[model samples]
Target chain A: MDKDTLLDCHRRISPHIHRTPVFSSRSLNRMAGADMVFKCENFQRGGSFKPRGAVNAILCLTEEQQEKGVVTHSSGNFAQALSLAAGRIGVQAYIVMPSNAPQVKKNAVMEYGGEIIECDPTLAARESEAARIVKETGATFIHPSNDMDVIVGQGTACLELLEEEQNLHYVVAPVGGGGLIAGTALAAYYFGKGCAVVGGEPIAVDDAYRSLKSGKIESNKTTDTIADGLKTQLGDKNFPILQKHVESIVRVTESEIIEAMRLIWERMKIVVEPSSAVALAAVLKEREKFENQKVGIILSGGNVDFRFKGRP
Target chain B: MDKDTLLDCHRRISPHIHRTPVFSSRSLNRMAGADMVFKCENFQRGGSFKPRGAVNAILCLTEEQQEKGVVTHSSGNFAQALSLAAGRIGVQAYIVMPSNAPQVKKNAVMEYGGEIIECDPTLAARESEAARIVKETGATFIHPSNDMDVIVGQGTACLELLEEEQNLHYVVAPVGGGGLIAGTALAAYYFGKGCAVVGGEPIAVDDAYRSLKSGKIESNKTTDTIADGLKTQLGDKNFPILQKHVESIVRVTESEIIEAMRLIWERMKIVVEPSSAVALAAVLKEREKFENQKVGIILSGGNVDFRFKGRP
Candidate 1:
């Protein structure tokens, strides 16, 4: 939407979300040969940046609308984020998940006070179930990454980062459904002194990268990436914002994402999911452009399952 | 060692080590049922609190001794810490490692500019090689946990913590060779308003707990615990310090340590070695003693290798 909307969203959600710390490592700096400031949303409420948008979206609704509660169809960080955020604001949350969703993910959602509505293991089933709940309960449907309120809310992380370090030359974030990068791009455009926004996408699910070249929405033929969070395709609501203000997107290999994730876990001593690593991997892959520049990286989430080998 | 020595050590090592952040989580606070503040030395230089002691010991050396450098017998965090500390002070470091030591550990030492001397897997061989190196090069020998200067240096972490939150009711640390817990006990006794010091020990290798009961330095019959950093026997230098000032040692099972470590990784979103988890495990095991109290827990280190199941 507008800068005012994003700033207002930040103000609304500030009390509910963490102004997560920015971390740096000397060895990591030496390895990338760049000055990197990481905005650790891994430490954010619900272990991800999703709560920023969820809280803002819920808070934006009128008391009457809020009284009706909210509904979302997802089995990822947003599910947990929405549940936690809604719980924090005293609003009921209905989370529709596929039957095949991992029990751990469902457990996390339940822990956050979300009412789980299990459907058949299919996208159509999830959406239809969520629609039925919304219809029955008069609950507002909040799309994970495609709502204007959510995008504005997500932008607050970048706003906080730029406020801390105004001289950053670039802000980098991993592109999944494009919400984070889009919000990051807008935050940089309005608040940053001269910062550019870059998106890192896994090559296996490079919808955002392809969309940038095609000048339209793109879809993935096969979602096979270690960064499970980035497997979702970009949606219409955030794509226009991404197209107008975002810089070029960089694609990284699965091996590179793993290497970057390991480096972060080893060097920075912070646990970040593989999706978060994609942004750092992009910077390492294209170090020449960012050499000696102060770059801010948005570590999107840290909700990883140690049981799974990858992409849980 | 006294309070003045610890204060001086803090000043000496202030420029070299990081004043790591204190982190708290709502879920963790609920789990422990206490106001737990984590002193994250896992984020310290050399990826652990070991550097605090290593640097102080190296700096305490005479100019002549510093010129010849320092030597230590270990294949753990101490080896890497000594090398990095010596390199920082422009001194040579000789590291005596068991032949069975992992290559990754050796590589870390080399990366920090330590000259590695391979020895038989036995502790006697490690000590003899270190002795030979000392004789040949006139390098001062520094025990990982037994030296006075190192003990005082290790106490600096508690100094910083108490300085930040003076109202802490107790300070807890994982008891290894009695260095961290001993130093922590002294810091709490002198600097803390009325804080007591508690030590966490593994049930498999409950040397510290047994030592506290027997009033003597006790050795582990079998060091089969996952908290490998704490398997070493308490030395004469630190044991007395631990005996006089420490409150009590709480023993936790290996499963408890893993559960605590997982909670920290999942909820706190920090990567800590299994040794570091022992303190939190102890806290969880004895929740009544710390109920509603302001407790400070020192996360000793974050130098874990993911390749092995444990104790890398």
Candidate 2:
């Protein structure tokens, strides 16, 4: 993607994304060995940073494209985000999920007026059904990642975070499909390249970490972690941007993820999903590099079910 | 207290108390027969409106009073708030809590650097233990409600709500020790008496509702509800204020509390403790009076464990 185009994406979707608050934590700072400023994307609309990219994807569609609707295969935050943002902007959204997706996510999509299409759990089954839905309905396919518009939307987080604190010495976020980090890095490149943009991951699904290190998108055959949102493979679009821009990739254990989640809840008193816990895990896991530096951690999402463990 | 003192508190603690956002749900409107604006006190500092009173109580202490440290007996939120706020300003905090209080609350007190002295469930045991702790430690007792400073702190929420939207039609909140209602009534008195203040209670602990009817503080023989915070009888200081300021009281069943909690988490996407649910439950149960009018329901706290039954 061209620099000017990325800048235009930032400009076009400016009003849609929430300029979430930057919170200071004396307790976290003392604990993490750094002065910490948390950009509260956990409080974002649809309860995650997906709205940025979801809106970007919907907004980029030709007027005719949005009218026909958009389809994606996500059982969680992405489904809810697409349904909500698309619904807000008068775009119909078709959510494709496995038949056994959580009732909560299903109810959320329906509440937002998203059309649901069920498939078996295999990727093959989902892709075939998603293809059929698009062909029959004439809807555009808004891949959760691997799309330019969505990448730009996710980048707005960096734009908003940078807008709040321009001189931050470091920026950290968890990496999954890399849409968020890619966008974050783009925003940091234009507004804050003087600062470091780092990525975090659970060692269980270290695809993003390995991909950034090896200069290729990587995948885990069978991932295992309690953070359902971080199970996706790095997208082709996301991998390049991350390989070039993300300063470092840190891996945290499952224990670290749970510990970080609890620690953040105890101190910050905010309801953060485990994906958001990843960025916090990085800061807590790698304390030496953060000492005395003004660090920014993007709490990417807060869509975790308090009642049930989401990951398989 | 004088009008100037109460008004002064409104100004002093304005920045500290989150003018908590008011959320409305069209779906909830359909169910409750009103366009409801839920004031999210669950999002407040220390996860309840208790901090407003706790902070106010701590801030108003004389230099001599401050040196003595602050002591309070609370089963939950007040303990956490007193611990958190008092510790922040370098004031020593001692909390007396029943041994049966949730693990989360115990964690909060310790996290806030409070010294917790466990006591039996009975008020007699709690009071004696608290007095003993205060005398031994040379601490000043900051009663959770039956005190002017706590009432003043609780009043700040009403002040902010009224200040933001002066013509609000009805205000509702759960009745515990009546600190919140006492504060709210005073705030509502200054803006508009035409706006009715509704106190909500669970049937299991309907003491406040009965007290308002009998023209005296009432006590429950035994309390049974997930809303542990709302199980207390009205205090001497707060009941009179409730009598003078409140317009009416409403009661909800135990099941309604769970349903109300689910409504908040599902629709507004906010995690509210069971105590916060009672206010919403009142509006939900008595759908007629609130219908079409602008109503404000304070989601007083979010410290409840969001556990579904059958969880380990």
Candidate 3:
């Protein structure tokens, strides 16, 4: 997409999303030996940046499509985002979630007024259930990350970050379904003076890293990472954007992800999911390239399941 | 302290402390049944509002006292704040922490360049150890929450809050050593137009409530609360301020505090210590009294020791 397209999408979704704040920690800077600015999407509505895309995709839909409602299959932040976005826009949202999904996730979607359609705990089952709902209710199916409108909407976060801190040398984002990284790359390419885009991926599910090396979208053989959100493979729509704009993809191990997540929570005093920590892990893993440079990292989400207990 | 005293303290400590942001949540507002603004001191330097007081206390010290260094007996946020504040101001800090204090806390104190002297866990031992250190080294002793300089410093948080949201109907703070609440009460009295001050005390250690009723300083028979930072009793210096200006004290049970803390983590996506949640818990417990009113709650700190593990 061009600059106007991204700018237009941002303007369209401005009223529906939060311009989440940018946070920095001296301890974190010392640890990485880099000047880092964290764009905290953990503070965004639905506790993630998914709302940017979900709202944009829904808002871009035709009146007829809007009236028919929107449907998606996700047991993660996207479900909550779509549900909340649709509810706010006075549109119905049908979330097809696996029956084995966490009850808290289900409750969150329902709290946002989304109707949950349960299916078997598999991609085939989820997709089939979503298709069935679309046929039965004339609902429009919105891919969590594959859709272009969603990608453009997701780019607005980086747009907001760059607007506030224009001199960032590099912009980093976690590679999930590739939407966030692709959108971030596009934003940096167009708006950033000379900012290079980078992706942080889990070594267990390094599809984006492999995809970039192979010059095509790649699939993951196993999704066995603590960063659960980054398990999905890249799609055709966003793959090309990553290929064109993204400079490199850095892979981090599970321990590295966990350590980074803990550091952010302990040092920054903010709750962030493991997927969001992947970016910081990547930066710390390869600090020499980023040392003494101003870098921006997107904390993609904060929907962590933490149990509060009595002090030890 | 009057308005000018508070103002001057804020200005003096302004360069050293953060003008922490005020956060609001629709979900929390809905639950509390009042429009609430959270003055997030949890995001402050040293992960608490203790720096405002620690820095002010250090800065107010005479040139000779600063040269001799500062000393305090604590194993909490104040220890870290004092260490960090002293380090920043180029003064030596001798922190008399109990030998049984958490290793992580000790590491934090050393990381901020504070020298730690181990003492027994009892209050008497802590005081004696601190006094011995003072005698041995001639270091100026700074109380965690008792001294007038520290109290005025702590009040600057409420002053910053009032500056941003002047029309708040009431300001609520957790009463521990009484410094935070006393400062908040004075800030509201001077800066807010008819704004009332409220204290949120743990039901398990409701010394503040009892003291307010008895018209004298009172001690807790048993300091058994999940909010570890708030286990101490109010001091004479701050107790008088609380008695004169605080409108009421609301006590919240352990369960209510846990629930409020969980809500902030789950919905607000910020890591707040249990003591910070006490203010919100009190407001939710007394919802009818604050119905449709604008309330300000100071989230006291976010230095929680949470163990991050694999997802269930």
Candidate 4:
């Protein structure tokens, strides 16, 4: 994407995304042997950073397209983000989600007035449902990650992150469909820090890592882990962007993801979803390489369903 | 406090305190039976509303007094708030805490550059330790909840809460030493809400409630409950303020406190320390009174010890 488009995208959606706090992690820093700066996207609007892109994409649609409404297939943060953003603009949002998606997430989408269509978890079923919704409702299919506008909108978060501190050695984000990490990579590379951007994924669903290694997009057979937000196969528009920008993709074990989640909540006192923890988990596994390096991490969301009774 | 000083306190400290998010909980609204407007002071700097008064008090200090430094006695949010606020002004802070105070809180005080002295938990011990620190160092002793500047400073939170949306029928806060509730009462009352500010306290440490009923401050023989923050006697300063401004104090059972904390984390998806949950528990108990009424609640802090997993 051109610099002008990126700049305009920032202007288009500045009000919707939260300028979430950047917290210092003394414990995580010591463990990773790096100076850690946490960009708390977990605190962002709609409990994640998706609103940044959703707002930009929805607002930029032509009047005719706006009249047609918007449609997307997401069961988690994007569903709520797009629905909430669309709700604010007096536009309807039709969300297609796998029937197995968590109730809490579906409830949030409904709360924001998003019309939900249930589908099977398989890619073919999800795509078919989304296409049917678009055809039946005459709503524009707003791709959660694949659209250039959405990706650039996601890029604005890094703009804000670098605006505070531009000299980071590494920037990291948990990769779902590669939109956040790809956009984050573009900002980190453009912000001029000799910066390297890393995509963090679970070993259970390491499509991004496999894709990077094989020099092509890849998919996982099934997903397992507490971070449901990162289970999606890489999107078409985001795959090329990911290959072009991201330095590497790291896979973290399930146990390591939980440990990282607990550490972020306990030590940093910031609320983050398990997916966000993957970035920190990746950093912790390679302490030697990151030692004392200035690293910026994006905590992707805070929408956990468990009731932590303050005890194990 | 005079009206001009109250107005000035709002202006002087507006930059320091974050006007945190107000989350709308439909279920909480249905359950609490009120249109709940949750004022998230748990997101406040110093992880609570303590900094409002501390910053105001520090700013009220004269040039000579500011240079001499500040001191307070507590094992809770007060110690950290005072240290951070005083440190910001390049003033040395000498905090005295009971020897049995949590090591984590003591470490936070030290991390903020406060000179910590350990004493017993009693007010007599606190006074002696603080007096010695002040006597030796010539620093100004800022009481946690008693001073006028501090009270007015704490009032700003309510002022903003009311100003944001004025249909508030009741304002509820967790009462420990009574700094926040007292300040809330003054602000809510002064704002012409004709609203009564209620206090929510843990049943195990119901000194604040007993003290309010007896028309005097009371102390527990031995503090109980996992809510380490609220195990305290009402202050000489806070007691009179409570008597003048407070409507009534409600005691919450420990189980209710834990249940409310879980509900907040699970549904609202926010992390809160236990003391904050007392306000929620109180609202839950008196759900009928709040139904359909605009209710305001303060989430007091997020500074929780690892031992408690940051909740009760």
Give the per-residue lDDT digits (tens) of candidate 1, residues A210-249.
Answer: 9989999999999888898999988999999889988899
TM-score of 4: 0.76
lDDT against the true structure, per candidate, is 0.91, 0.82, 0.93, 0.83
Report each candidate's C-alpha RMSD, comma-separated, in the order given: 2.5, 3.6, 1.6, 5.3
Instruction: Give the runs in model 3 whose Cα sits over 4 Å from its true position.
Output: A309-312, B309-312
lDDT of 4 at B221: 69
Query: Candidate 2 chain B TM?
Result: 0.94
DockQ of each: 0.50, 0.25, 0.67, 0.24
Give TM-score values for chain A, per-prediction. 0.97, 0.95, 0.98, 0.95
Instruction: Judge the docking of candidate 1 as incorrect, acceptable, medium or high.
Output: medium
Give the TM-score of each candidate: 0.96, 0.89, 0.97, 0.76
True contacts kept of each: 0.54, 0.06, 0.75, 0.29
Clashing pairs in 2: B33-B291
Residue B288 alpha-carbon offset, candidate 2, angstroms: 1.7
lDDT of 4 by residue, A116-154 (tens): 889998778988999988888899998888887788889
Find the candidate with the highest DockQ and give its number: 3
User: How badly does each model clash, as a count of residue pairs?
Assistant: 0, 1, 0, 3
Model 4, first chain, TM-score of 0.95
DockQ of 4: 0.24
Of candidate 4 chain A, the 10-residue stretch with the lowest lDDT total is A303-312
lDDT, residue A152, model 4: 85
